[model samples]
Every structure is written in structure tokens, then in C-alpha cells.
Target chain A: MSSVAVIDYGMGNLHSIAKALQHADSSVAVRISADADVILAADRVVFPGVGAMRDCMQALNETGLAETIKTVAASKPLLGICLGMQAMLSDSEEGGITRCLNLFDGHVKRFAEGLADTEGNRLKIPHMGWNQVHYKPHPLWFNIPQDSRFYFVHSYYAAPDDAEVTVATSNYPQAFSCALAKNNIFAVQFHPEKSQTVGLQLLQNFLHWDGAL
Target chain B: MSLAKRIIPCLDVDNGRVVKGVKFVDIRDAGDPVEIARRYDREGADEITFLDITATHHNRDTMAHVVEQVAGEVFIPLTVGGGIRTLEDIRRMLNAGADKVGINSAAVFNPEFVRQAAEKFGSQCIVVAIDAKKVSAEGEKNRWEIFTHGGRKATGINAVEWAVRMQNYGAGEILLTSMDRDGTKSGFDLLLTRAISEAVSIPVIASGGVGNLEHLAEGIISGKADAVLAASIFHFAEYSIAQAKQYMQARGIEVRL
Candidate 1:
């Protein structure tokens, strides 16, 4: 049995994400402690958030979950959603410059420059809505459709320092990375739980992935 | 590349139950907000909004409790609205785990609340919801007017202008609902939607008039909205968020397919 510990850092909506994973037949547990034992025990870990990057980073630091999370991600599957995903970056410009989990070699940037379409049309910020992902070849894409829709709601986006880590991309003004995967670490800018069938299928795929089987 | 459009599911809560409909006809009773939200999450909704339609000048606690339940259960971002008249209301919602707090009639009545909440909670935490309707006169072109109180009270303010003003007040997002198209499922009000989208710098979630996936695509691509917000369609099982997104993807709307 693969036990997945959902990190509870006193931020984020953890119930809904847990329900989705539970629906996919994975044993879901909400883990809030920074203890090394609890994290090392889980077969997988989920970091979920819906607040500013600064506070999320602070919670992890205050609770010492930051170090524990990194250690857990080294051996088991780790997932980040929304702010959780954003925190995985090297740093974020939200509420002034702040350090991030730095799990992936990337930085979170605001949509300072207006997004221009390929034909030069201006697109607004806080990218909210259902967008398609041009899935890049990765282990997380296993058992998932070539092109699937995921739900996104955010003003800032992640720009990975390493292009090879980008697992999926979406177009809004221009193509931007929507999903990133490196070994057992994976993060999606979009919310798979809110995504419907394609979203649910993606969760199922992750549950049964077995790290590329 | 064009940014992808989003699919959002909204719930109208009255006394802690999900109640919805234009003019609120044939109100279908649903389960707890947390349960309904989880189902939507499992079904792959991009985001969720809880409109506390029962909100009035008093009774903010009920709405806060509902938000607390939904927030505690749902892992995705949750936006809560209704009866948010002051900065305190916004604070309660955020404390209860709301990713964003939406202001409607109150924003029209007290514009300062928008700025105050945004300043205290950050602009991203504030969302201004506008209910729009077309007023017509004999032999005259129809005009858009803003409505509040769950589409009960009509404000003299222009929908587009209000949207622009709300953004200036630090609204991170706008939830624009078309009263005429709501529950009709005919599709979104493209003209009004585009006008608001064009005027605001924040992301716009076009609500009302979403009957099918094509509507979702048109609501985003044609209306140029950041996301499409629908209720009856997704709630009544007319279509799941996945089907709608797939349809939008086929139409080249850049959905998460």
C-alpha cells in the first residue's frame, strides 16, 4: 500500500486534494509535523496551498517542514499544487522578494509585462480558467492523454531554470510551462482536482504511475 | 501563444445549502458545501466559488461558517462572496481559509472596502463580482446596468465602468455574471463580457449563460475572459468540466486538455 502524506502547514485547502487522491484509491493522510520520521515513512507526499508564497514559505520554515519536505522528495513521489507548486521555486516576487522551497531550479515571476499573443494581442494577468496543457514527455504524463485540460488560477507563473524539467506547457499570450517533473518530484501550476475527468484521470495516473512502472 | 482559458464551478449557498437559478426558480437542494466541492474537485473543476446569496446587512457568521466548511474540505483555491461589506468580512473569510473574498453590492455601496481589503490582504485576495443586466426602452438601444443583492437591486452604475473602478480599487479578479443569460444557458454575454474584460487588468471569470463546452470556449476565446464560471451546467450534470475543457481544446481555446 502506498501511503501519501499531505503536508498541512496551516495553509491551503487540504481536504479537497485529499479527497481526490482518496478517490483514486491512494491511502491519504494529512501530515503537519516537521518530524523526519513521519515524512520518511510515507510513500508519497503532497504540498497544497492557496495563500501567498511568503506565508507558505514561512510556515514551512517555522515548522521545519521545509527540510523534511526536501528529504522526503528525495526518495518518494512529491507533488505541489498552486501556491505549493509556486513555493517549490528558488524564489518568488510575491509580497516582495522571498525565498522558496527551492526544490526545483526556478524562480516565480509576476506577469509584469502584459502578455502578447503570437499575433501581438495583449492578454491580462492572474491567469484564471481552464487551459490546455501541451504535455511534455515525462513520467507523470504516463497513462494520461497527450493533450489534457487542467484548471489554473494564479497571477504569477513559474519559470524553471532548467528547461529539461518542464513537463507540460500552456499558451496564454505565449507558451509557458504548466507542469514540471524531475525524478520523484512533480509540480503542476493547474489544479487537477478542479479539472473534471481529465483532471481526475491525471490524478489516477499519478496514483498508479509507479515511477514509470 | 494565448493563455489557456479556465473552467470554474460556482455554488450559490443559502442557509448552508447549495441553492441556485436565475430569479432563483426551482431551487434544487444539494448536500453540504464541502461534499459538493469535493465532488467537483474529483470531477476536475479548475476552481470553485461559493456565493452566499443569503447574505444581507447582518448575518455574516453563517456565510463565514459555510466558507470554513468548504475551505477545510477543498484543497483547491476557494473564492467566497456575499455580504462582504467591510474589511472585517474579508478578514474572516481569509481566516477561514478562503483563497479570495468576493464583493458585490457592498463594493457598489462602499468602494473603500475594496481598497481596504486589498491593502490588508493583498490585491490577489480581493475579487469584485458584478451582476449585469440589459435595460431596454422602446425604440432605443439596450444598455448595461449593474445589479447587486443577488441580482435583486439594480445600481445605476455602468457594468464596464464599475469593473474598471473595482480594478483601480485593487481587485485581483472580477466575477462578471450576466443576469439575463444566467440559468438560460444560452451562452455568455460576449459583448458585455468583452467590454469588461477589455477594461480591467485583473483576470475576468465570465459567469452565466454557459450551456455547453462551446459556450466555455466562446466565453474565453470570444469573450476574451481569463476563465468561464458556470453553475447549472456543471451542477445539473449537463456537462462535466472535463468534457467542456475538451470541447474548448478542440475549438483551439487552449484549455487544459
Candidate 2:
């Protein structure tokens, strides 16, 4: 009876992610919690978030789950999704320059104002909808195909200082790090729960992963 | 690759069952909302919109149940609309697992509701659905007028102007449906769609008359819609979602295939 704890820091779609995890593997026990003891006891930890980075950082600090998450990242397999992925970086330019968890050596940057494709049409800001991901060899990409489409809805992207931690890259107009992998930590800018088949495969892979470097 | 143009299949649920009709009249039973949603999810639908047509108090609970069931089965983004009057109602729908909540009549009656919802919840989860009809009068240039109450009552608000107002009020997306073209199956109201899409910076979903794959493509290529939402053509199995994606892909519109 493997258990996975989804850290709920008063942000993100905790329900959908919990349901997706259960849907990926019905046998795994999934729990959404903010308590440190419950999160620490789980075999794996998933940190998911939506909304602004300032609020997310405020909630994480207020709930004291920030320390718990850092402790879990040291020993167990830890996964972050969307804003959760951004929060793992050093800081973000959103909400008037907010500092983040700094779990990974990266900073979150807002998409430049006048971004456009090769055709020179003004691209929409949020960068909403499906985009393909180019990945390198990693446990999370075990069964998923190369250049698989995943759902993304964000105005900011993660720019890791050390390119070695980047596991996958996606492009809106220019390429950006979409997935980051280091030791027992894995994070993605796309919403795997909203992403259809390939997303479920990634969650299934995370469920079976052993938190290896 | 750019963000693929989305093709969304909408389910008009009444008392937990999906229903379809012409201009909100002569309704016919489609199927279980959950079942239809699951089928569409398997068929590669980019997103799903569940509009609860029932206005009764008891049915609100049933609508929530329907959303929960569909959300459990379908992993894509789900937008639930109809009878959402207050922040509590929006909270209920979202708590039931809906990713986005669409506001129409309530938004027209009280424009502040749009701002409040967008402020409480992130703008990304707030969608304003506009029902519009082409208005032609002597001397005045033709413009679309906004309609409410399931397209039964007409509001004097201009469609393009209202779309801009909604965006100013912090709405992330606009779902525009042409009352005249709805159920006619001729095609989407291209002029109305293009006007609103071009007017607002946010994404706009072209709804109403969608008879074929070409119409869907036209909504994106010509109308500049970020997404297309249809009911009857998909409800009757006249065309599968995969076929639509293939059609759009062959025509060089990026679609998830």
C-alpha cells in the first residue's frame, strides 16, 4: 500500500491532481495534506499550485509546509507541477519580485511583452493550450514518446541557471525549460493532470520511480 | 510548435443528462453527460464545456453531481456555465471539479460579478459567455447585440463593446455564441467572432453554428478564434473529434494528433 502525499498549501487544484494520481494507479493511496507528519510519512510527495507566485510563497511560508517540502525533497521522490514548478526555482519576477523555495538553481521569468512566432503574428500572453515537449533520458520519460504534447496555461516560464538540471524543453516563440530533474526532484511547467494520455503515463512513471539521481 | 487551436465539444446538461436543441428550443435528449464526456475524452477532445440549462434550485445539486462525474472521467479542462449568479454558485461549480465557470445572464445584469469572480478566483478560471444576435437598423452600421436568459431576453449591450468590457473586468476568456447562427448549422458567425476576437487580447471561443470540419477551421483561420465549441454535430456522431483534428492538421492549423 504505497502512499503519496500532495502538499496543499492553500493553492492549486489539489482535487484534480489527487484524482489523476488515483486514476493513473488505483492501488496507490493518495492523500492531500498540509500537516508535516502526514507529508513526511508518504512514499512520494507532489507539490501542485496555481495562482500568483507571491500568494503561493506566502501560503507555503505561513503553513510551514516549506520546510516540510525541503525535508521530503532530500529523501523521497518529489514532483512539482505548473506554478509548483516555478516555486521550486530561486525567485520569480511575478507580483513585484517574490522569492521562491530555491530548491533548484533557477529563476522564473515572465514572457517578454512583444513575443511572436516566425510568421510575425503577435502571440497571446498566457500561452494557453497544448505544446510539444522535447525531453532527454529520464525516469519520468520512461514510456512517453518524444515531442509529446502537454497542456500549458501560464504567462511565466522557468529559466534554470544550470542547464544540466533541465530535462525537457518547450517553445512558445523561443525554447524554455519545461521540465527539470535533479536527484530526487522532478518538476514540470505543464499541467499533466489536464494533459490527456501522455500525462497519465508520466504520473504512472512517477508512482513507480525510486527517487534516484 | 504554437499552441494548437482547440476544438471543444460542449454538453448542455439538464438534470444530470446531456441535451441538445436549436436556439434553446425543442430540446432532445442526448445521453448521460458523464458517458458522453468520457467518450469525447477518449476521442481526443481538446476540452469540454458543460452548460447546465436547468434553473431550478434542486437541479443545481444535480448539476454539481454531473460535473463531479464528468470531471472524474474526463481529464481535460472543463468549463461549466448556466445559472451561475453569485460567487457562492461559482465556488460550488469549481468545488465540484470544474476548472472554469462561465457567466452569462448574471454578468450582463451585474457586470461587477465578473470582476468579483475574476478577483477571487484567478482570471484564468473565469470565462464570460456572450450570446449575441446581429442587429440591423436604418442608418446605423450593423452590430451584434447581447442576449441573455438562454437567448430569450435581449440586452441593448453591443457584443464587441461588451467583450472588451469583460476583458477590462479581468475575464481570461470569452465564449461567444451567435443566436442567429446557432442550430442553423450554416457556420459560426465569422464577422461577430472576428470582431470580438480582434477587439480583445484574451482568447475567444467561437460557438453556435458548426456544421463541418471546414467551419471549425474557418473559426480559427478566418474568424481568429482560439477555440471552437460545438454540440449537435458531435452529439449525433456526424463527425468524430479525431476527424476534425485531422482536417485541421492537414490544412496546416496546429492540432493535437
For each of the candidates, the C-alpha root-mean-square deviation to the true structure, in angstroms, is: 5.3, 3.1
Candidate 1 lDDT tens digits, A39-140: 678777777777677888888999888888888777778888888888888999988988988888888988765656664445676676566688867766
Model 1 Cα RMSD, 1 decimal? 5.3
True contacts kept of each: 0.42, 0.45
lDDT of 2 by residue, B138-169 (tens): 57776999987667888899999999999999
Best by DockQ: 2
Point out the worst 10-residue segment of candidate 2 chain B by lDDT.
B21-30
Against the true structure, what is each candidate's TM-score?
0.74, 0.95
In angstroms, give how far residue B154 of model 2 lies from its true place: 3.2
Error of 2 at A164 (Å): 1.5
- Model 2 docking tier (incorrect/acceptable/medium/high): medium
Best by TM-score: 2
lDDT of 1 at B201: 74
Candidate 2 DockQ, CA atoms: 0.66
As for candidate 2, its clashing pairs are none
lDDT of 1 by residue, B1-257 (tens): 34466677998887777774332122233546666777777666667888887786444677677766765556566888877877777777776767788888778889998888776666767889899998766577656899876677888888888898899888889999999898787999998898888778788889998888788888877788888898888777777778887787788765543
